[model samples]
Target: MERLTDFVLRHKLAVVLAWVAVALAGTFAAAAVQDRLGARFGAPGQPAYEANQEIMRTYGGGLVPLVAVATEPVDFARLAPLGRVVTDPAFASDDGGTTYALLYPPQDGDLTEEITQILGPHVRVTGLEALEPEGGGGISLVAEILIGGVGALVVLAFVFGSPLAVVPLVIAAAAVLAAFLAVYGLTYLTDVSGVVQYIVALMGLGIAIDYSLLLVTRWREEGHDVRRAMATAGRAVALSAATVAIGLVATMVLPVPFLRAVGLGGVVIPLVSMAAVLTLLPILLATVGPRIDRGRPKPSRWAGWARRVIRFRWPALLVSTGLLVALSSAALGLNLGEPTSDSLARSGPAYETLAGMREAGLPTGALSPIPVLAPESALPVLRAVPGVETAVVAAPGLIEVIPDYEGTATVENVLASAPPGARVGGAVAQSIGFTASVYGAFPPMLVLVSLATYLMLAFAFRSLVLPLKAVLLNLLSLAAVIGALVLVWQEGHGSEPVWGIQALGAIDEFVPAMIFAFLYGLSMDYEVFILARMREEYDRTGSTDQAIVRGLGSTGRLVTSAALVLFLAFASLAAAPILQVKLFATALGLGILLDATLVRALLLPALVSVMGRWNWWLPSRLSRRATRRAPAPQAGPTSPAG
Candidate 1:
């Protein structure tokens, strides 16, 4: 750490110029990144994905087809100009007042506007792609970053109470651009998801600022001694970044391509951010850190709060634990699937058209018709399936089944009755396939991440119980975040009023897994920050209660400030028009805030105080095996201060 700091100080001008060049290159790369990104959600090797590929190969289109509805029957053949138009007697509503046809356009063609032009004004055209909220008024990526930047500036000012606030922002900007460059390179290697762009920008901003903030704050606390700060706080920043990377690693190892891309793209956020903090940031601090940090330091009130918690540990523990338990209970009701059509677009031509269909008593399931590839002789058997509303032999060896609704249950019923060689493929079936393929592997992934994180934290903190407690608390915090998501977005407890989105009926399929992977590590960041300091204090004072008070007092405000920065970055993503993006941002924002407050601030301190001396118990046998040498023992007072 000292050598790195020395090198940065020695070549301060070169470091600044190099970062400036990287940032400039990254700006251009960010503009081109969008074109390279994909939105594909197919899980390779899954039956539905394979089947969809086969159907698309045999027929013109296989994935969810665009539905065109009209009040009067016209020459349906006119729509053939767009693509293969599938029509059937069952496509018409029972009332005969409404009719619909499915258009399977070219795989890569976006024909919604062209279809609307050809079909004329009277025809209402809608599809999976068309159902997305226009988000015309929502803030763009630049605007979101600017807004988040402004919010972070405010928090930074409050934390440092000076021009030092701008330093972290600068580090954050360079880190974001660096991460963008990494993601751009990733695009050439793999099909990166469009979602990675938003994550890399916003999350990169938060993480970079967080690392810089920790380093700068510690530098100030260390009386502006660059080497001392780098040795102490710099180590914590590295550990914090590692924890964040550990969480993202879980996602990268998943079999899903897009998810793997997302995880791969996300991992660079912390790595680049850490690089900037450890390399570029030291130069900035050594040169101008003292000048910008001219504001008089103000004592944090969190120390008093910590002292009070120590004074009344039992009450603090009960209150915080009870709140987390209540919030976590809401997670039990979390449903994973694609959002319903009603939740897709609240106000648009597509929405009104779907509304008119509903008003005409037309089955909305026609919007997401299931395509099954089998012998034409299997049509009658599929149609007789309990949940299938209608089935038709659309081609020589292809049959399309319209279910009563779009859900896994309907897909399962069709699959059960399907002939031996049949392959069922559609949006719902794809979702089910994704759930089975991705989440089926989630348990082992979770175990792997947990065990790996436990080992890492155990080694870093040199304590058996502390690492265990941190892991368990992080899980509880994550559950609470999901529960809050369930209430806000899934159940519409506050979603409609706050974001103007209706109850989504279920969370997006990939959301929970993404949230778990990201949040587990992110929330653990605070665990490392606070616990590392507490361990230091315990070693110094040999009193558990004093360690708790001193540790929380020193790091509480910093953790809160850092978490607020991350939350703002995440909150900026809520302005996105995509429902999945909004849900992802909300979950992460809520998780950071909840973990920083309930889990880190109140529950963590209380629990540590309650555990007393056990918090630092690293058995000599375990310590020797982990570190190749047992750690020196330190005696501490057993009880919490009254």
Candidate 2:
């Protein structure tokens, strides 16, 4: 750490110029990166995905057909030129004024407008794709980043109270731009999700700001001694970034292509943020840090709060544990699946069309017709399945089954009843396959992440108990966050009032995993920050009580400030029109706030206080092997507070 800091300080000018060039190149690449971004949510090798592949090979489109509803009878002959158009007598409402047709256009093109034009003004189109929230393009992306950046600036000003506040933002911008360059290069190798862009910009902003904030705060605390700050806080920043990377990289273990791509792309955010913090930030601090850091430091009340908590450790522990447990109970009701069409969009042309369909007593399931590749003889069998509204042969050896509802049960029943060698593929089937494939492998992934994180924290802290405590607390924090998500989104307790989005009935399938991947690492960042300080004080003073007080006193504000920055970034993300992005953002924002306050501020300190010397325990054999140094000191007489 000293050598790196020395090198950065020695070549400050060269480092600044190099980063300026990279940032400029990245600024130019950012616009081009958006064009290369795309979304794919298929589970390769899964039954439904393989079947959809075959179906798409035979017919241009196979996943879900676009539904066109009109006041007049739809002309199937005119639509034939667009793609395969299938209709049944049952597709008409009982009132006979409304009729709909399913159009399977080539997957490469959209036929919604063409079909709407062909059917005239009374025509309304609603489908799985059509129901997605609109206008979440590059404009919204820039708006969100700006809003988040403004919020972060406010928080930074409060923290630093000087022109120095802008330094973190500068570091964040450079890191985010650099990550854009990496992602742009990544696009040529594989298709990256458009979602990655939002995450890279917003999350990268928060993380880079956080790393820079920690280092700068430490440097100031050390009387502008850059070497001391780099050796102490710099190590914490590196560990925090590594943990974040571990959490994101764990997502690559899932079989889903889009998720693996997301994991691959997300890993870049932290790496670049760390790079900027370690290299670019130090240079800025050495060169311009003294000039800008002219504000008087304010006195903090966190020491008194920490002392009080340690004084009343028992009450603090019980109250914090109770609150977290109460919140975590909501996760028991979490349902993972795609949102219903009604929850996809609230006020759009497609939304109005779906409402009209429902009002006319048209089955909503027609919006997600199941396509099966099988002989014509299997059509009668598929029709006989319960919950199936009707079945018709849409093409040679292809049967389309319209169910009463789009659900896993319907897809399962179709798969079960289909003849040997038959393949069933549709939106519901694909969703089910995705849930099964992603979650079926989740347990092992969780184990891998936990084990890896535990070892890393243990080595960094050189304490077995502290690392274990950190891991368990992180998990508990994540569970409470998920519970909050269920309450806000799935149960609609606050979603409607807060975001104006109705209850989704079920959380998006990928959301929970994404939340875990992100929040686990981010929440741990606080753990690393607070506990690293605690461990440092413990080593210096050999008094757990003093360690708790001094550590919390020193880092409590920093943790809160960092959490607020991240929360604001995610809050900006919540403003996006996309429902899935909204859910992801809201959950992460809530998680950061909750973990920073309840878990880190209350439970973590109280628990460490109650545990006393046990919190620092490290077995001699393991400590020697892990740290290649002397084992931790044996527990002495307890402090009067302990």
Candidate 3:
């Protein structure tokens, strides 16, 4: 590690140039990333996917479902110029004001232009991708990155007590740009989501800043000796990145490509971020740290608080445990579904026309109707299901069922009613299969993550019990996040007041699973940071209580600052117009704050205080090989006066 730091210091100019070159290369690749990205999330081999494929091949209109509204009477003649337009005259409004149609070859802008030329100025045309505030783009989220980056820099300044905090922020931005390039390159190897580009950019910024903060904090603490700081803190950063990356990379084992693509982004973000910190951060610290890091601030209040926690360890542990338990109870009410189209807001004319229709006494599912391919005989069975507003056979084997409500029950009943020759599909069914594939992969993901994280920590700490305890605490952290998600998004209790998003009565199905992967990796990262330091102190002193105090004193400010930066970074996602992004940002921001302050700083120390020497125990043979048995432990420090 010392040699590594020396190499970076000796070749500092080369390192900077290398990063700049990578960033520039990445910028070019980033431009083409969106075209390589796919928005589809449906699971292959599932009924929804199969049904959707069949519908697409036969109908040719399933790809570009839209609505066309006219202030005057409908004009079939005017719409003829648009290519491959399909709709029924009967579905138009009774007043001949509005009609539903599908514009084949779903190019939103071209279709909108063509429709506008034909339907006149009064026509309002909208489609699936048009309803969001921003439609498809990749790696160009400079605005979101800037917002999160500025907030992170402010927090860094406060943490370090210097304006030089911008150093780490610059490195983080470079790492994020580089990560975007890597994801773009990944597009050639396999399928990737355009959304992954934004995710990589934003998440890369946060993780990179976090890693740089650790190195800078350690460098300042070790009297600005960049070499020694790198030897210790840099090693920890690498291991932490591995654990973090492992949790995300585990998604590759899942059966779905969307998740795997997302997981790859997760892996790339941490590793790239870690590389920037290790390479760029050390180079800066060696050359510029002594000049910028003027002096050490006064010891933080965390030392005093750690004293109080150890003094009243039982009360602290019990109270924190109870609070976490209570918060976790909200998980019982958790239900999962993707965002409904209405919740994306009527940002375009198609949704505007549809919303107006429903308000004007159309069926509840007027905006979203199922396209089914069934024999004509199955019409009665489909109609008998709940919420069926109208069932029309457009062709010999085709039926479009418009339901009165948009609920899981509606899709389930319709699919269930499919006879021998029927196949049901639509946006709702696609979402169902996407949700199912995510959950289907979840159990394996849980076991995979638990075992992988456990093994990594076990090797890092050389203690069986500690790794298990860390995993359990990580789960507790996630439980609180999930429960809060349920309360805010599902129950709609505090959504509007906190964020501008309305409670659509369902959480995005993919959000929870992705959240679990990210939170697990991050919580484990923090856990390793704190516990690794404690283990170092315990090995040196042979007293658990003293080790807890010193370790918390060492890492308290750094961990909290990193968490705050991450929370704020994730919070920046709320600026997105998507409700799912808002939900994810809110839950993650709250979760990080809770974990850093409550779980790591306070609760962990108290629990370790109670456990005493056993917190550092390893199997006898392993202990003999790894660590020397300390002589009989001395008494710990007495409680200090406030």
Q: How high is each candidate's TM-score?
A: 0.93, 0.93, 0.86
lDDT of 3: 0.75
Query: Which residue pairs come into collision in candidate 3?
Result: 126-350
Separate clash counts for every candidate = 0, 0, 1
lDDT of each: 0.85, 0.87, 0.75
The residue ranges of model 3 lying beyond 4 angstroms of the native Cα positions read 6-17, 31-35, 62-140, 338-362, 625-642
Superior candidate under lDDT, 2 versus 3: 2
Query: Candidate 3 lDDT, tens digit per residue, 1-642?
Result: 778777888898999999999989888876777788887666787787788788777765553355565556556445644444445665666666566554444333436666777777777665444553351122336777778888898888888777668888988878887887888888889888766766787778788888888788878878888888887788889888988887787677777777788888778888889889999888777777778876556587777888899999999999999889888999877767645556554445656765776655655464467878888788788888887877877566878787786567788888877777687888788778878787887888788889988887877787776788898888998998898888876766777566544555667677887788777788777888888888778767867777788888888888988898887777676666555667776787888888998899877888888877666556666655554563223222342211
Per-residue lDDT of candidate 2, residues 1-642 (tens digit): 889988988888899999999899999888899889997777889988888888878877556678888888667557777777887676788889998888888763456678768777778788877775442432488999999999999999999999999999999999999999999999999878999999999999999998998999999999988889999999999999999999998789988879888988999998999999999988888778999998977787899999999999999999999989998999999887766686677777888899898899888888878899899999888999888988888889888898887666777899898888888888778888889999999999999999999999988988878989999999888899999999998888887787666677888789999999988899999999999999999888888889999999999999999999999999888887677898899999999999999999999999999989887777788778976878766453562434
Q: Which portions of model 1 show Cα errors greater than 4 Å?
A: 93-97, 105-132, 342-362, 621-642
Best by lDDT: 2
Instruction: Please report the TM-score between candidate 3 and the true structure.
Output: 0.86
lDDT tens digits, residues 2-78, model 1?
88888888888898999999999999889989999998887989998888888887777547677888897665668
Give the lDDT of residue 602 in candidate 3: 74
Worst 10 residues of 2 by lDDT: 633-642
